[model samples]
Target: MIKATHRPKHSSIPLLALLLCGLGILALGTGAVRMSPAEVVQALLGPHDETQARILYELRLPRILVGALCGALFAASGAILQGVVRNPLASPDIVGVAAGAGLAAVVNLMLLPNTPAWLLPVGASAGALAAFGLVYVLARQSGEVLPIRLALIGVAVEASLDGLRRLILVRADDSIAQALIFLSGTVYGADWERLFRVLPFAAVLIPITLLLHRRLDVLSFGDETAKSLGMRLEPARLVALALAAGLAAVAVMGVGILGFVGLIAPHAARLLVGPRFGLLLPASMLLGALLVVAADALGRGLIPPIEIPAGLLTTLVGAPYFLYLMRKTGRVR
Candidate 1:
């Protein structure tokens, strides 16, 4: 028993890292042209064929990097939200968070075609913050946060928001092609500029998340227990929720709403490494990155000169897992 338990704990982090590295290499090498791994490595190291070099530098590298970053952020945000809400179903995608971002993004794209590119992310961030505050307010009762009530409220809000989004999409005069793709979430057109835009936020937020890991662990242990342990319940919850919303918003802006990675990765990591927040967070981030990179690579390679959306693949993969988790919990109600 001890060996079995110890083995996973020891192997989880390294295994996740190795998987991420392998996926990164595969994503770089396997596309329409199909460069060998050696060529991919050479291109990354320096210059190879100028044409291939441009493809790698300008196109594939950024998509892979942004996919990895967005995956990590989403997964980390899910883990944090799950811990705080004490509900496995409490992912940003499941709740109203992604819908909030999507609503703003879609509205902006439809109404303000000429809006500065940079402002898209800003709008997304604002929408996310607003949604987070709305959920928290609805979830609070007499200075106490109730997990089940919060989750139910979130589900209702999400359904309503999703309905609104669909209605907007249906009535709009513009072509729905771009709106559909963005709703499905793909990293296809990501470039170095987009990567650079989100990097600073990811760099800043990930470290803060790491630092707050301990506090999150405490928060997971019920409100009364956390209070007994000297945690400022409301303030800590607000801060964590805000950070998570910002992370989720930035990711959606960067790569559209790639769902499932956030919900699936953290749960898988928890199963592998146990529920210790410290190990869980980093392991989930790496595994999440790996999943998106692999999915993106598969999307490109699955069809010749045609690709599926990475978000669609993630949803296909995630839905079964979500169902299984619900069953494990013995009904979502």
Candidate 2:
């Protein structure tokens, strides 16, 4: 009798989720004023010493939560975009949403340095929506948006807007620190205030995206096929784009322009879960949260006094993967 081999298929989602939880715990416990697991739990459970409570609740926990939320939102946006466009490389940053939000936020930082904190996200959202609208218009022909054309036009717009952002930064004064946050991508100052600012948008948009997961799977097929199947391809595509871009915009408002989470998370999730949006969507969210939190933790731990921005770390990690992906797909053109 031949020995039978029974190999279980590897499941990454659970591991990724567990990793996110671990990273969150470490993020709360491993800062300058370290706390034990019991103390951390006590701080979380409340009715604890004032100092430890402040450290855990005010300083550390909010940042971790914000990073996790931003990562999940960015990943969901990317998944929605890739499915709608049927292009694996489609992401909010790649498609000009981040550049637009960054540019607008920077402009606000420059012009209205004293503007109420609440207005920053509104400006960023407006900019993102405008940029997305422009890409859609540029990519549309007769009445339909083409995938390749959308990608090409979005890339072009992203480059142009990025250049504009650089030019504005060079000329602007007294906004370098804030601009650096946008350019380098860090959640250094994430707090409950910023988290609350972003929560309403994510709370609403994320559920909507999850609900539309099936529609995304349908949209992955060509437009004619989708239409033949009684799907409203154009409207559905626009709604998905709006939701994805909105999520990215709100996250940028909270955490600055953390690029590549949207791009990388979806690809990783799809590879793990095989393109079924039902599984892929949640998997991307978990992977994304894990990536950002882990990157943020590494950024904090790599040097005691000095810290690297999470955005820079992600770019370092994501750019090479992106290049490899492009080469593999022969999609560099």
Candidate 3:
């Protein structure tokens, strides 16, 4: 069980938020063309230089917003999945959401390149929902989706989807760059439209996830305890999973396969703020925002004009943490 920390638990919220704010400033000021703090501040207020203003307003600001929004959404989704499954290892990636989105996104990019740009998100969202529905159904036994069953079935489904993705990649010779962009995950070309694409889901779903903190808290006590406490386990689980999938889907739609933020951010928050869902959710969001924005900054500045995909950096970092978590949770068991 996750107990409250020795230090003040709530302090993490502000600390994370402050850190995120600082990173946002850093992201705004440092890129291909460096700007001083004062210059960035001035640009925000309105700048006479068209070049500076365009770089700040048209290039930097939108990517930062989309990165932050997608990061927060991914964290909220991860937190919800972890709570609902009563598994510290659970995340949107673990439960087939990212796999679904990735597969659908690849198909859209490769097969339907001529379709409207907006259809990518729509197709990806539908694919995510379909994968979840399959997992939910296949995992059900006598109307109950056991956590173990759900996890196992989800992994199988995800592996199968991944196989399909690889098959598609090998057989195709066209739209490889476009396909790779969604698969690799990036905020590189993010602009006002991308920001707008991801904003609504973050605004709506994050609040709903917050409102369900009591349920998440209750669910964390395990299945029998939730049932004994008069909670409808199946209904609540479905709802939480739906929200989690939706949050993850939009993120995949907006950027690409950013699988690790959902996994990493929640545990980081829980370690600092404890497992209380109310605090954990918001803290995860802030940390996730900070994480992606920082990753984007790192990618941009790491190689100068050459940028790394945000997903690659996150997976590089989150993969080790995931192994550590598996071992830690195993030892506890």
Candidate 4:
């Protein structure tokens, strides 16, 4: 009985890891031109044939890696924020981080067309941090970050930032299509260059987030409890919020507004593995990665040559689930 009880607690990590590997393989193997699993492995491991090498290395591999990284970033960010605010609905996109990043990226594209592409991510991170800080300042009352207030203020801020994003996009005569496609959240043209662009930011943010699980757990137990246990509430919260904002910003800068992964991955991870942030963090990352890979694969396969964006697919799937979550939480009002 004791062993059985402990088994479920630890099983989720390995299971999620396995799921992520399978999804990664699936994402690589199935596209406009399908490769068998053997071909996928051979391409990954061995002497590179030109055709297989081009398909795997040039196109599919980078997209798959970027999808996985973006998913991990968003999921980890959401998990951190949800734990910090003690709200199931809190996510980067819902809370204005994505919108802020989007606004900054749009502005960057509009104003400095000649700027190195790398600076876009930096601008996005700055915007996301600024937006989150603004929301926190507006939402906090009596030194407490209340759930409803935060969510409402986040939505309001998101709406306002979204307007600015549109304003920038509208002024762009030459780059409008590019901006719209990006806003719709397509990893359509992802290549090694884009992969390298996002890798550094996500590479740094994700490991740091996983390391913060203990602090997140302490914060999740309410400010009074955290203080009683000698955890500094404000500083801890700041670090958690900053980590989340940066993670989400990097994801947005990479993938162009993945709306659902951040919100759904954490909830799904908690359901699968329980709310222990240590397990929860990694599990959420894997789950989010799997979600995006699967969505990308399905989107590519669903309509043949005309591919749907993974972001749009996720939104379609996530909206109803979001409603269900709200209903369950009894806070839809």
Can you write out model 2's per-residue Cα lDDT over 135-240, one digit (the tens) per residue? Answer: 8888888877777888889999988987998888887775545544544578787889888988998999888888988888788877877899899777888787
lDDT of 2: 0.81
Minimum summed lDDT over a 10-residue window in model 3 is located at 1-10
TM per candidate? 0.92, 0.89, 0.94, 0.90
Q: Candidate 2: deviation at residue 63, Å?
A: 0.4
Q: Which scores greater on TM-score, model 1 or model 3?
A: 3
RMSD of 1: 2.7
Model 3 TM-score relative to the real fold: 0.94
Residue-wise C-alpha lDDT for candidate 3, range 82-166, written one tens digit per residue = 8888788888876788778768877877877776767776688778877888888898899898888899999999999989988
Tell me the tens digit of each residue's lDDT in model 4 across 1-333. 112332346787898889788878877888788888888898889976789889888888889888889888999999988888788878876567977877777777777776575676677767887888888888878877665677789899989998977776676776544544665677788888888888888878887887887889889887788889898777788788878888888887678778689999999988887777889999889988888888889889777787999999899888998999999999555
The RMSD (Cα, Å) of candidate 2 is 4.4
* Candidate 3: C-alpha RMSD after superposition: 1.9
Q: Which ten residues in a row have the lowest lDDT in candidate 1?
A: 1-10
Q: Which wins on TM-score, candidate 1 or candidate 4?
A: 1
> How do the candidates rank by lDDT, highest first?
3, 4, 1, 2
Instruction: Quote model 1's TM-score.
Output: 0.92
Alpha carbon deviation, residue 242, candidate 4 (Å): 0.8
Q: Total backbone clashes of model 2?
A: 0
lDDT of 1: 0.81
Off by over 4 Å in 4: 1-8, 46-49, 114-118, 140-144, 168-174, 331-333
Q: Judged by lDDT relative to the true structure, which candidate is superior, 1 or 3?
A: 3
Q: For model 4, what is the C-alpha lDDT against the true structure?
A: 0.82
